[model samples]
Target chain A: MSGPAATEAAPAVERWTPLSRISVVAAVAIIAALAFGPLVLNPDWVDKLTTLFIYVILAVMWNALAGYGGLVSIGQPAFFGLGAYAAVRLADAGVNVYLSLVAAALLVGLAARPISAFMLRLKAGEFAIGMWVVAELAHLLVNLDGLVQGETGTSLIAMTAYGAESRRAAVYWLALAAMAVLVGVVFVLLRSRTGAAIQAIRDDEDAAAAVGVRVLATKRLIFILAAAGTAMAGALWLATAISFQPKTYFGVQWTAYMIFMVLVGGLGTFEGPLLGAVIFFTIEAWFGGSGVWYLVGLGATALLFSLFLPRGIWGAVESRFPLRLLPVGYRLRGAPKSL
Target chain B: MTSNDDGAILAASGIHKRFDALVVLDGVDFAMRADEAIGVVGPNGAGKTTFLSVLVGAHQPSSGRVRFRGDDVTRLPAAERCRLGLARTHQVPRAFGGMTVFENIFVAAANGGGFSRGEAYDRCIDAISLCSMMSVANRRAETLGLLDRKRLELARALATNPVVLLLDEIGGGLSDGEAGELVETIGELRRRRIAIVWIEHIVHILLQVAERLICMDAGKVIADGSPTAVMSDRAVIDAYFGEGAA
Candidate 1:
């Protein structure tokens, strides 16, 4: 308050950290390796990794909505179910399964605009439950469709056109591509002006509004984007499993998994969901055969994380180290040396 | 009704706010010219904060109109009002805990001022420098002490490039030295020609920067005049103390 003594000579501010730079190169190498996963790894591992990619997509989108936007939606399965059903209907009409997956995801994203307008009116607990009601309603509506034969469900029979090895590789690559694109989208968004508004809204809605942040608009954007990303993951899951059951697609259990992964990984950090998805995939691959016990173990781990490491695994690590794999924050440093 | 032709930058008339029969504000009417610094003093429950809220569009009045620069902004949400150059700081600092101080100010510059990235960066730097917050610009806002938090709140509002800044008890709990520093910063803002409506309990510090004063009692303006004249008014004295004592 004395004067501008300290800021008279302002130092430069940069966004990239040392670890973030290394992360970029490492990420490229890892993604390149994963691209050839079907050829290098066994078909079963390929299938598992594909499922892991889907988990990453769902976890990242959920984190964006709940962690960044402060919109804790327990009804993301609404769009997920809609996407699966859209893909199924398209496939049944003789469209290519892969094209149906992409188209269905876009269609669901569009559908989310109106849904978000209504859903965003509810806050906190009401918003959470309102989304669940929407998912349940979507499930019932899909049941009424003739293409969806009630509880018995239907398969993406068009997928039979591809050979087993070809299908597995294609689905793996599609899931990987979707995961990469969606994660990139979220990353760039958080680095943008709108991303700051979203985080501000999450921190304090009234204060954010007082500061001129368009709270409802920012929340609505995140809601629609999360819906689209979740739908893509759902469509990819259908590709891998080749089944379209409204009960399965619209089940509340999907949202439960998303919450578990995000909470266990890190709620708000960019790298948290990725770490969480990897840990979740490892657990599911190892103990998923244990049935109800697997679910119980997941619940317990989530509880432990929430109780002790409330910031999640990546959050705990970030607190200890000056590392950021996906840095969306700014850091001040000395002026750069002249070239 | 106050017309915009008279050169009032912000004006509120017939503001009646009630919460289930509890009238917080009763037909309060006020106006401020461009670049004028007005201090508001009142006893407890005088609805000073609610008045600021109504002006900033944070709360809707039961039956009233608020005009900002000739536009009817009564129905506008707080964010839209802010983007139109109406910004405020809370009595209790509401810094975004998860963001760094610089990020907090930058958000106000970008979103509130609707500036481009480069412009926002420059505006944020200017605000931080003016508020003497450059030392903790990169610190997490949640980690700041009370004085720093208050400075951040002021800096955030300044970053919005507001035509009128509504400050709610920003100097309330500060030490004498800290409050003096804030007054200096606010005085600098006055020189820059940003109109300020500061509500403060510390009348001496309020008098330092404010040429005009308005005293409220029971949600009505009991006195409004020059700082010394308003302070000496019988109504203000009676409201602050008691009728017989005054």
Candidate 2:
């Protein structure tokens, strides 16, 4: 089982320790298996998982924005709707659906700069409501023109070119890829200087400013990042549905679901949202056929989780175990252990 | 802006600060030499801390000029002033409570002082070691006791590699032994030629490190001279120690 004899001059300290390497490798292997799932799973299951992936992205983005950045926004659906509309319109114009998805997300990211300039001026609760107002405004404007077909809605006709099986497979892979890339970006950023500065601002704005952290600028960056990732998830959702309505895309329910997922998972930790998304998706898949009871159950579950486990499932687990699958912050190591 | 001009690292002239008709600082003029230690003594609400805040860019003076090495920095923000090597510790000991002790100093050295990554790490280690905080360097700042928190406040400011350090009542709540330890740290800092302006109620501790001492009351300087003379001045005795105290 041993690959080689022990080297006498191994490093006393390592930035990428063997334990961390194992975590990274295990994550990559799991992702690869998920990417190949459409090959064996039924079309309906692949479709269900595609929806789960989009929620995963939403939950993760919301967690970072609120949990780490101290910006609890309720208006993320604004960009989500914009991205969905962009994707549908581009596909209608005969562009590649995949390319249109990316372009729509980028367009949303660009719009975030100006949006943040206005929204970030508001403090915590005001900021949350401000985002909702922005989403409502976007909904009204999208209905103003025939470009989105207003209330009549529209479909992604470009998808008709592919067979049902191939279409399902492509959509699943696209969702998986988008989730991996966005989560990976967040992971990398949380390990960098920008992440440190953002956490500093989260802890104390005045102290962070005194230490030369550009407070407003860092908030703006996080706002834009959350917007971009949320928009990309929106675009993927449109691809999954192959159809969209303004009311459907711009619903406040998206924000509610995001909050539920992250709240039940944990706030600041990386594993919280991922674990939350899986649990929520599993519960929905099992009991969703009951319609209104399903939603009621979800609401009750969220309330119970909030009251009993304020830190969420992952948060509780982390407190007990101190497990860090993605260790971004530093932990001083003891002297090297003897074999 | 020359660092050697007038041999002063910081100069504030005709500084005035008011909050809705309440004058916190009244036409205060102060200056610090490149290698000097000055002590400020006054009763509570005498605007001692307010003066330090104005000097460090935490407050905007109503009408005045603040010169750092002969360059006006009155309009600059707190972060900019910190980056330019003017740093201060808060009276309440504000440490970055969520971060480790080492991370707190690292952030100050890297961001406030503009040191490179390697140099900032070195500077942080040096600062904590100087403050005798190496044992708690990995601990979260919020977990520290009063003495360690005070040490962290000082160490965090020191990590900024300041040209002129403004200290506000860091010795107020310390035991005599703890205060003595802090005095030793400040003495070591003075040996490095860093200008120090310390505001303290502990007159004896102030007398030990400050070559020149100034007394203020009702937002104006009442006495300015050598430490011994200022301590014994009739006006200082009346304003700070009360007329009855010998």
Candidate 3:
């Protein structure tokens, strides 16, 4: 009889997940600011940091799509532009400025349903290039006059409607709250069955399908979810800037900057984007004047990350500690083996 | 004499398949009775695997209808076929490399076998037990050896609780002793009343479990009879044994 199984020791995984540690700190820090930052930091600096939080949200959205879904899209500006437009239009029509951003975000993400039907027909590389073309078309149409004042753009005129500085500060807080919620939603989804299926698809599609996963539906859902969340980020961005131009609203550099952060920090791991975002802001502060060189260096770094460390920095870190901080799966360690 | 009328669980009549210009299955007809065990054998490029593909809904035949329990299901997707109690393994094992062995079995049990999570977890243990692989359940599939891999492939398929199982070369790369053990396990499956169409080159193992044997050549059934009679038939000998003469 195989007496008590000769137990080979189980592989050691993570003691604590990077996902939990990072997100806890991030959320607590943001909430702490809402509770106490007004007492310590200068209001001007707080306002600037709030704007940066919007960028963090954008990077998180792109990371969810590319790092997790294996979709490298260079044209997220289409949703961002539409979202801002939706926010401004609804506000012009008497909706609350804050409500407009939320509505706009949801609408832009939902509007992509018909578009995804067309986009899904394209293969991997073609689909990416197609998004670029679509973004350009969307930008052109919005600038064609009679829609949100076309080329002249639209302005909220905060001074005329209410006290300008206070409204601006309130909007900053609103933007901060939006980023926190979006990040939480994405992280939760990533740790669910849907997240597991997407991760499996990222590794290999045919294998995922053989296990009874619905590949297309999962991808489409995430794509739309990311798009909508990104749209909200765009609305808040415009709200903070207090000005919207077709060129500025539809800038490709927004996607470029977010991709750089995602690649530098990590793709699949949660903390990578935040880490990358901080690194980016630091570099921009140091090398403020070397404009094109900043672009060149950023591009080069992304290339290196893609070619050499395809898993990203956090991926490298996690390999040493295989235990997932976000332990979404309920594991069943079968009965103790009898060797 | 080979007709089955006890509510043919899966029936394929006048099925033909072609890959581009190369004709593969030429008007082949096959059927699985409620609990019959049949083995298919053929030379290379003889459409044996192709027949399984058509039956499992992995590929569409150029022509001919497929019926499951008397209802036409010729154009269903592979996963849907699995949901309807049809399961198959590849000629080469197709285990998901990134997944754990237990996770793989869990998928087969839940998604294909129509079991709940608790039930899937239960069946996964049973599947691992059947393959004698409880020791390596937590290991990644890419780390498994060839013999264990062959065992895993059948165990996963069996985990699907398939009423009509299509196995392609299940015994191809196994050791003789392991193959003997597998033949006994498959014999156990036969006794449990699972219809099987096992395609393999290992004649003796198939002979031990299959009540009927089919020889396919040029996408058509060349010989169909009792295992000994089919093996002894001159055409079967000429096509299979003739290769050794060359």
Number of the top candidate by TM-score? 1
Candidate 1, residues A1-339: lDDT per residue as tens digits?
324443455656678877788898898788889999988999988998999999999999999999888899999999888988989988899888899999999999999999988999898999999999999999999999888878889989999899999999999999999998999899999999999899899888999999899898899899999999999998998998898888999998898799899999998888999999998888887898998888888888889988999879988998787777888876544322211
Clashing pairs in 3: A5-A338, A5-A339, A13-A323, A14-A323, A17-A325
Q: What is the TM-score of chain A in candidate 1?
A: 0.94
Relative to the real complex, the DockQ score for model 2 comes to 0.34
Q: Per-prediction TM-score, chain A only?
A: 0.94, 0.91, 0.87
Per-residue CA lDDT of candidate 2, range B111-139, in tens? Answer: 78888867777787778778987667667
Model 3 C-alpha lDDT per residue in residues A173-288, reported as the tens digit of each score: 77778877887888888755577667656655654555555678878988898889889888888787767787787888887888888988878777778778777877876775
User: In candidate 2, residue B160 scores what lDDT?
Assistant: 87
Residue by residue across B86-163, what tens digits does model 1's lDDT show?
999999899999888888998899999999988888898788778877678777787889989899999999999999
TM-score of the second chain for every model: 0.96, 0.94, 0.94
Higher-lDDT candidate of 1 and 3 = 1
lDDT of 2 at A20: 72
Candidate 2 pairs with clashing backbones: none
lDDT tens digits by residue: candidate 2, A200-268: 777777777777777889899889999999999999888878777889889987887888898899877
Candidate 1 regions exceeding 4 Å error are: A1-9, A334-339, B2-5, B244-246
